[model samples]
Target: MAKLRTTFVCSNCGYSSPKWSGQCPGCREWNTMNEEVEEKTKVSAVSSVKSKTVFSSVSSVTEISTGDELRYNTGIGELDRVLGGGLVKGSVVLLSGDPGIGKSTLLMQACGTFSRDKTVLYVSGEESAKQLKLRAERLNVNSDKLFVMTETDVESICEYIKVNKPEVVMIDSIQTMNNAEIQSSPGSVTQVRECTNLLLRTGKSLDIPVIIVGHVNKDGAIAGPKVMEHIVDAVLYFEGERNYAYRILRAVKNRYGSTNEIGVFEMGDGGLSEVENPSQALLSERNVNVSGNCISCVMEGSRPILAEVQSLVCTSGYGNSRRMSTGFDFNRLSLILAVLEKRFGYRFSGMDTYLNIVGGLKLDEPAADLPVALALVSGFTDKPVPDDVVAIGEIGLSGEVRSVSRISARISEAARLGFTKCIVPRSCLKQIKTKADIEVIGVRNLHETIANVF
Candidate 1:
């Protein structure tokens, strides 16, 4: 056999180089280059074949046909909500999470629903057919229309799709699938890109929705080339500790619907069960009269969720005080501490502080800012915040309380959860016209909030 030419490729940024380099110039990372077999192609033979571009006249928006039915339900309400109603036909979705994060189980459960009326094909590249069967049996997913095949070759999977013509298809994982035409390995950039391209073409051409599972790196981002995320119609991430029973499904990108929507599920012995009332589930284990604990209402999409923010403040023995946060941004915590120290003259300089959001739910929005500040101050002063009170506002650098969006929804959720008092921004208070069952108090700054809460 003739010598097969090879080239060095950067695994991180997918930049190719003629020779080896200790550091990749593209991403400026050290020693990420790997040698891969380079397939030589005869370009002269195909140069004469010119592909003509076809153009069509643009039509009015009213003329466009959005069929009678645009989406199909996955039979799981929470999953359907996260998917922006239901799975859009001909739309490609990429689902990624850590190892054993119930990605496969969730997809399999959706498959069982799709197989009820529509033919569904599940192409697994990781697990064997028997292994899948046993797992399916354990999950109690039985459907005659659900077909399972264990294959890694992208070409073979395409062939199966063409022959079966299933209404919905799922690739167990994109990393495991490979295109024979690509000289690189299965999980390499070239193979993953080509395989996803093939699947995208197949799904679009057949008007079938395709769901591809992805692997996440140690940094909690989807593994493989960054372009993989851009090529898909939607990107869903599974979040929550593996040790915890609850899992959150959030959409980072969605072409058909809002990305703010989230799906809550509790991993049980049978399968994942949807948590209809997530706020209740999240605040069920709250201990009353705790010095460092405070309730906050944060809006997740259109849904209002009540979360517990806990803080611990103690005098630091070390020279440099340590600050730690779980399910909360560390930089945000530091900024809040700075505001408290500079504006209010409260010293957290010699203290070690820790913050945590209960139920493994991350507080990404600014609405939790005031509650976190309250929790921190409460911990430092060794005073318990009112148990029946829920805080909702954003803290500014000048120690002023700022208004948050969907303030009405947040207060309403807090009221429904049996909270008697709600502390909100003064600006947001004017927006509420009707009287709620709960007592609403508006504060202009953090000092007024501290006076009212403790």
Candidate 2:
């Protein structure tokens, strides 16, 4: 043995210190330092010289080969859409979600598809081979080219990969993996960082794509050092309530494709099925002519989706009024209410206000502001917005309806969905040249919109 040493490391940020402290200096998180063992070995001069000799000359960006042939379809259209067409060769992808959020189910389905024409290896550190088989049987995944192995040691997993030469490899989770060279326990910051680097090297060296599953913390962030995300080529998050059947896949970072795209999937008894027409499915259960309800068309990536915005206004029982928003920003709701009171003279201070976005979808774009304001006003007056209308605009502090991007696509989608009327900004009306039969009404401010819409 060369020497046994110990040091304190911050589990949140991977910062090392000679002694433990109450707070991590790097991440400013309290009580996250843990003692980890280390064995120090000095490299000889000859070994150091040989390591320096292994460096390769850098190549110009123009000299690098690039084409569509490098992409591999994972057999799921929704997944392919999120992945910017398909998985890239020699790329590393990290998939993260809440527990039991169908991360494994989605990947298993993809593996079944990839195994049809290429070899795939599924490594599980948390579950036994028999347990994975049970899931595969439940998912009805029967592929001759898919291989499964239960292993926790990263080095041994790499050895198996080297011998088998799998076309693609999937680690069930990076947190459960451990490196013998690192004395920290599995899931520690050190082990996660080192193991991911090793897997990244293996993928690049073998020209194979590797997919790694990750767990999310209570804050809904990936449970690892930030470097783990920086190392991967793409970072995808699975979002949606576990109780709901709908799940949304979003890419936060992508080296091979655009990050704004999102994929929608519906969880079924058999597994996950892609939602081909998300707009139609989202509006399937709308209540016609209901007070406090208004439809809005917002763009998700390049696709336009129509969703219902609902609001409720009632007298406050307590001394202080309460404001609550679900699937909509609470601060933005307050701003809208202030604008309504200042510009339209609507009294919202003495009442409790509630806002919700239907279909379990979050509305983050500014284009939703107009519909939200309309819904608030409709609820306060106990009047319902027109069933045949859809609103698309951004409301500013001056109560002015601002033009939103891609107005043509929004109106076209509304028309396709059988809407006969569209409430949009006056500036956007000038740009619309569509022959769609829908009547597009242009409003300059919230006052005009309230008079015309109501």
List lDDT for all candidates, in order. 0.87, 0.87
RMSD of 1: 3.1
TM-score of each: 0.92, 0.92
Per-residue lDDT over 186-224 for candidate 2, one digit per residue giving the tens place of the 0 to 100 score: 887767877888888778777889999987753312235
lDDT of 1 by residue, 1-454 (tens): 4346788877667778989888878888777776777766523111222232123335788997877778999999998999999999999999988889899999999998889899999999999999999888978989899999899999899888988899999999998998876677777766776688788878876789999998875331123535488889999998898888889999999999999999999999888889999999999899999899999999898999999999999999999999999988999999999999999887999999999999999999999999999999999999999899899999999999999998888888888989999999999987986466999999999999999987
Q: In terms of lDDT, which candidate is strongest?
A: 1
Lowest-sum lDDT 10-residue window in model 1: 44-53
Clashes of 1: 0
Residue 240's lDDT within candidate 1 is 93
Q: Which stretches of candidate 2 lie over 4 Å from their true place?
A: 1-54, 66-68, 219-222, 225-227
| Superposed Cα deviation of residue 227, candidate 2 (Å) | 4.6
Q: What is the lDDT of candidate 2?
A: 0.87
